[model samples]
Structures are given as structure tokens and as C-alpha cells.
Target: MTDAFYDSHCRVQAEKMNDLAVSDPKQLVALSEQRYEAQIRNVCSYICNNMERSHIVLLAGPSASGKTTTAHKFRKMLKEEFYVNSYVVSLDDFYIDQCRLPTLPDGSKDLETVYALDIDCIHQCFDQLTNTRRASLPTFDFHTASRSIITNDITLGDHEILIVEGIHALNPLITEGLDASKFFRLFISVKGEYSLNNEVVLTHEDLRFIRRCVRDYYHRDSSLERTTGMWASVRAGEKKYISPYKCYANLTIDSLILYEPCIFHHFLCPLIEQMDPKCDIYPRFERLYHILQYFAEFDRHYVSEDSLLREFID
Candidate 1:
């Protein structure tokens, strides 16, 4: 979609968020959910329209933009609506083990860039999948920080789509020597900024941070200290490596659900309230705590189990 359309929707959603918070909070939740579902359908339609232009989709998004859920949902919609079968693969499984991770000039590990991955292996899998219609993909164990046992070879059925999703999926290095026509490049992001009385309360960055914090703490067993501490480097990596490559995307999806903050505030506020003031990450959490209060929370159980918000809150 055009920048104009995205900006326009951001403004409209912000206004709707503020108004619906008071007049009809329930409607706000339903409408926001509907908007997000429609956006996913629109993305599927776009891909369907250009089916000939692409079969291999490279999907990427920054942390907590719901890239994983989006891919799964997109895959589901493509099958349910269009009767297309697809397979989704992640770059995390392709990372070289932490012990063997590449280092910088100062000898510190450089884990942020694409080079940290088994690039040749990725190319091999992609090449094999496209040419031979099958390849065995590896799995990575985050707890062990190493590649797991290899899985059985997977085959791409005739006329089926293959989706690769990760932060670096759009990087030119991954696409080197690949045919552009057979590949569709898709990127996910949150472009909305929620405001109140003409003052901005939540930014696109803040939305992602909140998502990561909730997911990190509740789902990943990560403390606020760890999540906040790593956020700076994570954002720096996105700016340097991910956003720069978005211009090459066939479509960049704005994955913001305007009502997400409503649900998030319920879970995040209690955690923030318990944060130790003397902690190093307290200041960062304090800022978000202030922003979270602006949102009028609703019953989180009201949300669908399969909702994209579940990616963060589950």
C-alpha cells in the first residue's frame, strides 16, 4: 500500500482509539480486530494477484511485530480462501551455533548481522527447494543456542508457496543470484502512533517494545532487565540491517492492531509496578509504565486465542 494510505489509517485509528475508549470500548476492540483481519486478507489477495510474480515469499519484520503469527495466518488464509498449500521456514534455525558465531574486529561476537547465519546453507536449502522441490531443514534450540538434529527433507508441492520469515529475510545477501520473478518479498511493521488530545502517547517503537516486553517476560522467561537491556542493540540492528532493506519489499504490511494497547496495559502494568526502582532498566520501564496507563484496558480473555496479539500476550 501507499505511504499516503498507511499514514491516513494511522491518523484514523488514533482518533478511533481515543473516541472508542470512552464511548464504546467493546466496539473499538471488535473494529480493531476486524481491521487487522482485513489487512491480512488484503495481503493474501495481493499475493494471489501476483502468484506468477512469486511463489517463494521472503517475509520479515522487526521484533514483536508478530511476524511469526502473521506468516502462519497468511499461510492459513491462502489455504482456506484460495486453496493453496504453503510451508513456512524461519531463519533462526539456520543460525551458526553461538560457539562458532563470527566476531568483530575487537573479537566480540557479532550476532546481529546476516553473516552470523549459515548463509551458504541457507542458499543451498533455497536452491534445493526451488530446483528439486525438496530439502531437509535444520532446527535450532534456543535453550542450547545450537542447531538441533536435522529434520526430514520437505517437499514443495506443485504450485505451492514457500515462505521464509525472519528479520533478515529481505536482505540482498540472502537473495544473491535468485530470480526476482519467482520470489515475493514481504515485510511486516507497525506504523501507527496512538495519541491523546493532540499529544503522542505511544509511538511505533513503543508499541513494539511493549509487545516484546510482554512476550519476553510472560512467554520467554526473560526478565524486564534482560529485555530492556537488549532492546537498544535490537533496535540498532533493525535500523542498520532490516529497515534499510524494506524498500525492496513487494509489500510492507503495517501490523498494528489499534486495540492491542488496551489488552497489553492489563498485563504489563502489574509487572511494571513490581519493578525495582534501583534496577538499571527501571527508567525505561518507567517511561512505558506511564504510557501504558493512558490506555483503558479491557478483558484480555475477550480476544481470540489465535489473534496476533496472542503472539505477545500468550
Candidate 2:
């Protein structure tokens, strides 16, 4: 969990990735898949063993740690044991309207900050679930940037598990005054302890930056310049909104792929090449480019969708 530990591991993984790139990328992908499955199994068992009464599990993690995807996978695995199902409620649906929200430090809309969430409504939702009462939830409208509590009702049936995934899911403000015995918490992060040459530490932010670069370009049609420019603010918001409550979890999931940055380099480098000189991305581009030079690239086809990195890379 210290920076030094992660940095050292990043160096070892980078060297390992270099060796795998030249020797066998397929084996490297297989290794990542194995680790991903093991992590899922570990967390699932922890939940099944510890969850006694109502199974309201709070899944918290840094951005891009495959929390949503892991929820889906965990639900599937839980069904194999019993006739139970999980309801995934995204905190994204609770966001306050962007038009009404306050501005960010750099004057852009601070959409990701916890202040943008309506605390009272979230508390009510948790209350409804815990009490076994029917309650309609609010859905945020991204297009018009508004919110409306659902008029339709949903009653929790027998054997229903509520799996909430979000940046602020662990904030005590969201679950304050609730019975601690009725809830379980898990903290997840791309605790990638990979290193390059044992000197440079590959922080989670490094992995996330590349993921955002690829996702922004491919999915959002955003240029690398824009994503790179917004990174500092994004990180600041996460620290403010998500990180402080990590210790509240009963379990932690390390969602990291040792050889991922190698695969990410293939997609990210080309995108980096397109950034204009005047864009604010030049400094990070130069730094990451130097980092990329230390590790070799691998074929994209070797990567599996089950890999923790598939959230961004796929």
C-alpha cells in the first residue's frame, strides 16, 4: 500500500512484461486471467462467509477498477450456489443535476465530486432497502441534466442482494445511523504493484491515465488532449470523494494486470501522437512516452475480456 512497494512491483512487472512480450504474450494474458478469477473468488467467498443477515454490500474502489463488471461477475457466481440474485444500483444515478451543481476548481463542472450527490435521497434509498419497504429511486437524466424520483415501485423479494457500486458508496454520510451489522463493505482499487527497473513506481494513477486516454478516445470520441488535460482535477476529486473511506471496507480487491500497460501502450501511444503541441498534455505525454519506452509492447489479441483491465482496454 505504500508508494515504494507499488513502485518496486511496477518495475518487476515491467521487466516481466518485457520478457513476456518477447517470449510469450499468450502466457502473460493467461496469467492475468487467472489472477482476475482468483480475486473474484476470494471476494465472493469472503462475502458469502461473512454476510449473515441482510446482504447489503457496499463495493467501493477507485475509478476504473472494474467495480461494475466485478459486480456482474460476482452475481453470476453467487447464483451457482443458491437461487439468489443481486440488484446493482449505480451511484451515477444519484448525481445532482449538472446545470445546478457548483463549478469545479478549474471552473469546469465538478460532476464527480460527492457534493454533487443528493445525500438525503441516497439515505432514503438505503433506508427503504434495509426496512424491506418498497421505494421508487431517482434516476438522473444525463441528456437534460436533471433528476426525478421514480414513480413506479419495486419491492425487494426473497433472497435479493443489493450490490451498490460507486465512488461515494463508503462515505458514512450515505449510510450514517444505519445498523452496521446489516451491511458489508469492500474496498477495491487497481492496486497495481508493478515496477519498471525497480526505480520508478507505477501508481494507480498511471494505469488510470492510460485507461482514460484509450476510453476517452474510443468511446467518448474525446481527443487525448482533453482527457490528459482533465486528469489532475479527476484525481483531486477522487481523493476528496472516494479515497478517505477505503479503510471502512471489510475486504479489498486488487484489480491489477501486470502486463496491461504493455497492451495499453499499443492503443494509447497512437492517440498521444495526435495531441497538438499547444495542448496542456505535452508534459504528461513526454513523461509517459519516456516511461513507455522502458517497456515493450505486445499484440492486443492476446488479452482476455475477463482481465481486470478489460474495463478500459476492451
TM-score of each: 0.91, 0.88
Worst 10-residue lDDT window for candidate 2 reads 1-10
Off by over 4 Å in 2: 1-11, 81-83, 105-108, 148-154
TM-score for candidate 2, please give it. Answer: 0.88
lDDT of 2 by residue, 1-314 (tens): 12222332344456656676678778767766776777777777777675557678888877677788888777877777544666777787888887768786568787767778888887887788788645677777677888865543556666667787888888888888877677888887877645655565557778877777887788888877677667777778788878898988888887777677778778877766776767666877877776777767887778785555666766
Please, what are the lDDT tens digits per residue for candidate 1 over residues 1-86?
12222343345334546556667776666766777888888888888787765678899889988899999998999999988888
- Per-residue lDDT, model 1, residue 248, is 88
Each candidate's number of clashing pairs is 0, 11
